[model samples]
Target: MLPIFLKTLPFFAIIALGWFAARIRFFPPVATEWLTKFVFYFALSAMLFRFSAALDLTSLWDPAFVMAYLGGSLTVWLIGMAVARARGLSLPEMAMEAHCCVIGNTGFLGVPMLVVLLGPQAVGPVLMVLIVDLLVFSTLITLIISGSGRGPIGWRTVAPLLKGLVGNPMIISMAAGLVWAWLRLPLPDPLVEFLDLLGAAATPGALFAIGASLVARSASRIGPAIWLSFAKLTLHPLAVGIAAFGIFGVQPFAAGVMVAAAALPVAGNVYILAQHFNVAMQRVSTTILISTAASIVTIPFVIHWITGGLP
Candidate 1:
């Protein structure tokens, strides 16, 4: 555990540095926004594409892995909803809280960190987890929120959902890369070098962006924030671990990666959804802030246990 913690320290340190910079007015909010856009649209997309292009779909796709991750995520999602309902939250608010419980920062944090820690093989499982979260759970929340409000689920809601999925750069890049791999197309040397150069920026840029963004989030609504954080850093991973290991019997390596991914903090995008819907924005923001701070310790412990002190 100590060794794993040591290995992870620099990542958190970078985050702290970003926080300090932002707090001190060195990295401004505007700069953080642009940095996030660059990483999301360019650097991270390049990385995903390169990784996806290198591997065939057969090696990447696993029905059992998908089922295990979905089952575990849904378990936590339901628990979150129940807790929110018990607290007398509205349907949309309950959906938002449930979103916080299950959607980890897989795109920004998990992909770069897990692949580096667990190896290239972790890419497939991590991507699968990201896909499940994006496709299934994200869509579910949108539908729930839409249906709960003004009228029935009509073309208005479904159209934007479909558009968002289609327009998402991560999904597009991954799909393009997979198609390239399926056709057995060799990446030109120049293109490979270009992608390598761009993707190299993803890790540090993303970590820094996360830290800078957290500067604006205050620890308001402590009780619910802590509950959501606990759900994310503890319950989420535990449920996923059980499903992957005990129920679905996923391959050990993939299962470990999935568990680690599950252990990540509440995604930044969850706050975006809350803000968009004008529901529980403070709670979501607080959860992201708390969960991320907590994950600095929780993540290393999880990695140490999953690797059995091997690495």
Candidate 2:
């Protein structure tokens, strides 16, 4: 237990630094966006790229666990969407809220954090979730929210799907990294070292951006945003846990990843989707910020209790 906190503290500490910077208005709202963009497209992606480079496919392709994990997330998204519709929200807003609930911050947060807690091997399972998070879950959310097909599959519909793919730097990084790793091509020393330099900046840079984003005003309602946060940090992990152990019989390392998946704060892409589609960006953005800050504490406690003593 002590070790868990010891390891988790540094991760959260960097985020705290970011939160402090945000509070100080170091560069104002616009600068926050720039910082976040830098972290997303360059720093964070470089680390993930390296993580994937070291992944061994045989271990990562656990069909039973991957299918169950992906399947569970899909179910959660469906139910969440249904509920959002029942609330009579607009499709774009529904996408925003629903995405907040279902998608966790698996990329920027998930990769580096898992690397710290579970070592290089953890990259394997995180990779599995990243695939589903980017390729499948993101696509599904955009298809539903951006277009209704009530009249026709206009450019409106196609555009959202394309945007879901290309606009997300994390997803693009994952795809490119996977292809390179699969091909087993050697990365030149200078290039790998350059990536390493960028990779090293990933964790702290992302945490800071998340903190800064939280400080800026996003147009979101208090009630809905709080509810979204509660759902993401608490209930989402429970759903994943139950399914992993009860339905899939996921054990040990694989099951640990289910916890990580469940524990991720919220996908950074949620805000982008929200902004593009005119959803509650303030609420969405803040929820991501707050939940991510909260997760620094929440994740370790959950793992300490549920990890079944994985020293």
Candidate 3:
């Protein structure tokens, strides 16, 4: 027990330490944005390319994984949105808050962690999670946040969704990799070796980027942020666990991944968008930090509890 706990400690430390550095402005502010874009656009793209290359399209065609993930994500989305509305949040705030709660830090945190803890076997489930994130969760976010202008589903907002999804770095990466995998193409030793070097940087780079961005947000709105963090930590995972076990009867490693995802902190992208639009930045940042810290404990226990033993 002590050994397992100690091993998991570094994962938590990376995020917490990174958050502390971001608070102090360790990286130059100007450099941070560029670095973020580099991660979002470039690093993420390459990371997805690597992830996509790992699996055949036939693995992607698994309807069960898709449905289970969507069911879990949508269930949380609706519940979180309703809670935001009940709290008397305006349309924009509600949309932003709901998105923050639903979308986990899947790319920055989920992918690398899955690869390390679950090994190459994690590729399939991780791919499924990524697909659900892009196609289901993000698309749903856009659709909810975009208000109808004089009619239903305005084209102006719709364009961003199309652009974002179509032009998305990860999605594009996945598509390319999917083609390569389907064709069963082999890369030269040099390229494979090169990709290995690039792949190694994904986790640390993303966690650092997340840390740099976490602080310097709406620091005043700590109240709402704490509430949301509480929800994200406690409520979201409970919802996923219930459905995964009760409805789908998901067991073993798949159940572990689903529950781990549910236990994830608020996604950094929400913070980026919130800050971009001048929405609830402080609260969102707070939620990200608090929930992430909490998950350090919650994740291990949940993994142990749900798996019927330590996995």
Q: TM-scores of the models, in the given order?
A: 0.98, 0.88, 0.89
C-alpha lDDT score of every prediction, in listed order: 0.93, 0.75, 0.71
State residue 105's C-alpha deviation in candidate 3, in Å.
Answer: 0.4
Error of 2 at 54 (Å): 2.3
Rank by TM-score, highest first: 1, 3, 2
1-311, model 1: which lDDT tens digit per residue? 78889988888888899899999999999999999999999999999999989986877888889999999999999999999999999999999999999999999999999998888988899999998999999999999997796788999989989998999999999999889999999999999999999999999999999999999999899999999999999999999999999999999989999999999999999988888878899999999999999999899999998889334
Tell me which of candidates 1 and 3 scores higher on lDDT: 1
Candidate 2 error regions (>4 Å): 154-156, 217-220
Model 2 clashing-pair count? 4
lDDT of 3 by residue, 243-271 (tens): 76677766557766777776777887777
Error of 3 at 116 (Å): 0.5
Q: Which candidate is the best by lDDT?
A: 1
Best by TM-score: 1
Better of 1 and 2 by TM-score: 1
Candidate 3 worst ten-residue window by lDDT: 302-311
In candidate 2, what are the lDDT values of residues 137-245, reduced to their tens digit? Answer: 7777667765654566678677768865787777777767777888987788998999999988888877777666666645357677677777777777777777777
Candidate 3 has which clashing residue pairs, if any?
218-282
